[model samples]
Target: MKARILFVCLGNICRSPMAEAVMRHQVEQAGLNDRIEIDSAGTGDWHLGHPPHEGTRKLLDEHQISYQGMKARLVAESDFETFDYIVCMDTKNLRDVRELLKNAGTLESRAKVFTFMELLPDKGIADVPDPYYDGNFPFVYELVNSGCRELLKRVQADLKLA
Candidate 1:
């Protein structure tokens, strides 16, 4: 089975989608596109069906990463069963995801949920700040890029991929 991964954030138009694109790029580069699946969603439905924020699109374009066909969507109960890893952007997102899972009685899901920063504990950062509010798309891209690189390493090890 393919190793399925999901990136989550509050709006899905900024951080999570950015992570999604970056992770997808790395996965393709590693030739693991056929072995793994990647997607992203938001904890809220405010931006449902909307494309990623302009900052996210601009930065991704600058990096030559493709965020094509990625529309904002809310996290669904089915995601717990579909994804092997659900990575959140911050503590609040993590909490919301866990609460949703608990409320839906799917807390026993096989998926391992965690914050993106958990993959790099040495970074000393707990959250990937929202570029939508701060307009610091460049900094956010750097964080997402670094986190996605580390995440790919973890996924490869977990899946025993070379």
Candidate 2:
């Protein structure tokens, strides 16, 4: 069966959506699109039905990455059971997801959750910083892009789907 992955963030407008797009591109480039299902959601419903943040869309466009046909969705109760992996962008998101899945019962066992950067050798720096509150769009883009590349490698290695 195809492995299902979900990326989570505060509002699904910046970090999580960016990671989702980056990972989708990587998986398709590796010709594993059929073997992997990628999606993104927010811990809160603040951005529901909203498009990704403009800066994020622009960054992806600058990289020739298409993030069209995507919409923000809330992380549903069923997501705990549906996704094989629930990757959060930051520690706050991790806590939020943990709370959401706290009473999900056995779904907890099958749900593998972590910050996207946790797959890297660096442990403490895994949380993707929220750039919406700052003017450092370029730096945030670079950090997220680099982390996404590392995350792709880990995903490939872990699933042996490389």
Candidate 3:
């Protein structure tokens, strides 16, 4: 089975979608597109059906990373069963996702939910800041890129794709 990954944040328009695009790019580059699946969602429903934030779009365009056909979506309880990894952009997102799973009575899911920063503990950063407000897409892109690279390695090892 493909190793499914879900990137999450407060609003799908920013960090999560950026991470999704970056991870997708890396996966395709590694030739693991066939072995892995990637997607993104938000803990909040505010941006449902909306495309990524303008900053995200512009930065992605600058990097030549395609965010094609990507839309903001809310995290669903079923995601617990569907994705092998549910990566959050920050601590609050992580808490919200776990709380959602708990409230849904999905105490035990195959998905391992965690903050994106957990993949790069030495970075001394706990959150992938929201560029929607600060307009720091470039910095967020750097964090997302680094995290996605590490995440790909973890997924490869976990799924035995490496």
Candidate 4:
């Protein structure tokens, strides 16, 4: 079965979407695209239906990473049941997701929700900050790039990928 991953952020226009695209790229390059699914969402509905932020699009463009077909959407309760991992961009997002799960009464779901930075080697780095406000897309991109790489490595080992 394909392992599903869902990236979550406050608006889904910056951090989460960037992580989704970067992680997808890493999975595809590793030839594990068929074994893994990538997706993203937001905790709030403010940006629902909106495309990723211009900053995110531009940064991904520079890296030749495609964020096409990505649109902001609020996280549904089903996400906790559907995705293998529901990774958040920051502490607020993580707390929001946990609350959502609690509200859904499925807090014991199979999906694991945590910060995207949790996969990073440095335990001190706790978040992939939202770049929508300060336009710090480059910094977010660098962090997501490494985080996704490490996430891929973890998935590779977990799935016994060749």
Candidate 5:
């Protein structure tokens, strides 16, 4: 079976979706798209059914990354078991993921939950700041793009595809 990844943030209309696009791009470039799956979700329902934020779209467009048909959706307990890794944007998304897992009686999630910045061990950054509020979409994309590169490295190693 293919390994699955899920990127998560508070609203899914910004950071998470961007990360998804970035990571998917890398995976495709590696010719692993058929062996891996990527998706994204929000910790809450604030932007459910909405397309990614304009700021996010702009940054992605600048890079020619496609986020076609992506819609914001809330994270669910099922996701804990569906994805191999649940990559969150910040601490809050991690907390929300934990809460969801616990509520489902799965105290420890089957999926490995990691903060996106955790992949950038040497970058000294700890969170993928929300561009939705700060309007620093470029900065967020920079971080996510960097992390996604490292994340793809780790995934390839984990899947013994290196």
Candidate 6:
């Protein structure tokens, strides 16, 4: 059975989408794409149906990461039940996701939720800083790339992928 991962954040504009795309790429490169399903969403519905933030799209373009055909979606209540792991961008997102899952009854035992940063303590970066409101796209790009790389390592280790 494939392990499903859902990335979450306040808005689906910046951090979450970036992490989603990068992690998807890493999983594909590692040949785990067939056994792992990756997707992303937001705690709120603010950007639902929208493409990722322009800066985010641009960064992906620069990296030659194919993020086309992706649309932002609100994290549904069923997501907690559907996903094997729910990864949030930061502590605030983690708290909100926890609250959401707690209220969703069946999700109470269906998912393991965590902040993406928690998987990579050795990097010393606690979170992927949101750069949507700010003009610094490069910083957000680098943060997501770093986090995704570390996350790929952890996921591979967890799955014991050779």
Candidate that scores best on lDDT: 3
Clashes of each: 0, 0, 0, 0, 0, 0
So what's the TM-score on candidate 6? Answer: 0.90
Off by over 4 Å in 5: none
Better of 2 and 5 by lDDT: 5
lDDT for 32 in candidate 5 is 97
* Per-residue accuracy of model 1 over 1-162 as CA lDDT, tens digit each: 589999999989999999999999999999889998999999998999999999999999998999999999999999999999999999999999999999998568778999998987888999988888889999989888988889888888888875
Segments in model 1 whose C-alpha atoms lie over 4 Å from true places? none
Backbone clashes counted, model 5: 0
Candidate 4 lDDT, tens digit per residue, 34-58?
8999999999889899999999999
lDDT of 5 by residue, 25-44 (tens): 89988999998899999988
lDDT, residue 75, candidate 5: 90
Model 3 regions more than 4 Å off: none
Model 4 lDDT, residue 153, Cα: 78
The Cα local distance difference test for each model comes to 0.93, 0.82, 0.93, 0.87, 0.90, 0.82
Clashing pairs in 6: none
Q: What is the number of residue pairs that collide in model 2?
A: 0
Instruction: Give the TM-score of each candidate.
Output: 0.97, 0.90, 0.97, 0.95, 0.97, 0.90
Instruction: Judge candidate 1 against the unseen true structure and give its global Cα lDDT, from 0 to 1.
Output: 0.93
lDDT of 2 by residue, 102-129 (tens): 7555436376888776765454575677
User: Could you arrange the candidates by lDDT from highest to lowest?
Assistant: 3, 1, 5, 4, 6, 2
**In candidate 2, which residue ranges exceed 4 Å CA deviation?**
105-107, 123-126
What RMSD does model 4 have? 1.2
